[model samples]
Target: MTIKSNTRPVASAARDFLLTDSDFSRVRALIYQRAGIALGEQKREMVYSRLSRRLRELGMSDFTSYLAQLEAQHDSAEWQSFTNALTTNLTAFFREAHHFPLLAEHVKTCAQPVTIWCSAASTGEEPYSIAMTLIEALGNRAGNASVIATDIDTQVLEKAATGIYTMEQVSKLPQERLKRFFLKGSGARAGQVRIRPEVAAMVKFGQLNLLAPQWGLKEPFDAIFCRNVMIYFDKPTQNRILQRFEPLMKPHGLLFAGHSENFSYASQPFRLRGQTVYELDAKRGKGVA
Candidate 1:
């Protein structure tokens, strides 16, 4: 009696909470709608991992339950938590060093009051770098220069507004610049540094979701540092945002992009001025590629 084994192995569920396919799709759609972040299929695990902490914090047992709460009220505080969890904020002082020198040169020639916008103010680094550049370029006159820093993530905006950093964060800065622009922390705050009041005062911080219908910028800027942010959006989305930026800039305003982004397809009113930098062209660079 040769009895063949007909037993089927039972499938095991993932530990802690089950993140079903339905759950992932639901989450992907919601995040894209709220924040314009395109979460691909590969991000399923990342979404599960990042938002899992949120679930635990809210005593939620599964993604279904957690997402339900988020969907129920689009304007809830949980929405902020969800956005904060997903938004990537990897930045450092002088991430693009070359841009500052060009910026200093641009500021030197501006006839009107120079105004610049750091479109992605991640943890204060980029905006602070701009402030330092201006200070060096215009000396004490830099205090009068205007900088508006904005980010979609409220959590990062709060951190940026504080202008505080770890010692290692400012390590790239020259010793003289460090001593001039930042204060060394002591006692409980040792190993940390804070941007000096004067430098911090040069910029203002705000929460702005670029996907919104209205951007709330009152006047056109002389220079806009929208670095490294367009990589997250699809082509059409990128084109739409670029078109929106065109009218917002002065006749020859500069637009600085992230290293990985290319505006050849979307940029109409801007021409290549430097690597990842564009200058306003009223004729939309029609004849010039």
Candidate 2:
């Protein structure tokens, strides 16, 4: 059996843990089963580094013991930590600015209450961006819009719900826009800004594993942002999730994808709307004919 590069050759005595090939394969499989994240072989080293601290916090010396304990305990909470550890979260406010314009247009025209789901909310920027766009379009009526921001990583969701960010973190936002939607901290909390109550009120955060069998959301969304996170999933998983999303979307509801993912592979259920944005096929699922 070959030891994985990240844990093999006993590279240094300073290394506290060993992540064997077996360990890598088992952990990756578990993550896929639990969260639909398909980490490739190249990620072995990265996973080792990310989860090593988890092992340390558990007082375990190696991956084998930690994994066995997980299996023996059927530790669902522990599994969440495992999922959070391996998931990659890279997001920004208005990360893909173009999508928001059409989204805003949709919200403005929507007679029915608008609902948007930020499927991989990651630290809250995207959902807040969605909220800001809705606010601009609907003004006081923005209260009628719904934004459900979710992620499998509860850690990030907690931070996302807080809606607080460093000035430097949000400096890219235009100054006037920033002042309009955010509350600048003072004194003890200087250098940070919190999403104003009205904007923060627009979003509701939850921990959702996309691969989970049942999605409890009652209402179909007008636009769904399941962006850059899909690149971590295999094609079949991606397609399955897209299919599941079909029934959960309005006929012309748009699906925003990440820059790195192309939904053509899952085109049966979604048709390209714009760059990395898709709309549910009218003929598929419950879409209007």
Give per-residue CA lDDT, model 2, range 1-289, as digits (tens): 9544554622355577887777888888888777878888788778888889998898888898888877877755898898889988888889989888988887777766788999999899999999999989888888788899999899999999999999988999999889899999999989999999989998999988898888788788888999998888899988888888888888778899988889896656788888998877767748322
Error of 1 at 241 (Å): 0.8
Residue range with the least summed lDDT across 10 consecutive positions in model 1:
4-13
Q: Which candidate has the highest lDDT of all? A: 2
**What are the TM-scores, per candidate, against the unseen true structure?**
0.91, 0.94
TM-score of 1: 0.91
- What does the lDDT read for residue 229 in candidate 2? 82
RMSD of each: 6.3, 2.5
Task: Give lDDT tens digits, candidate 1, residues 212-285.
Answer: 89988876777899898888787888888888887777777889998898998774788889999899884542
Worst 10-residue lDDT window, candidate 2:
2-11
What TM-score does model 2 achieve against the real structure? 0.94
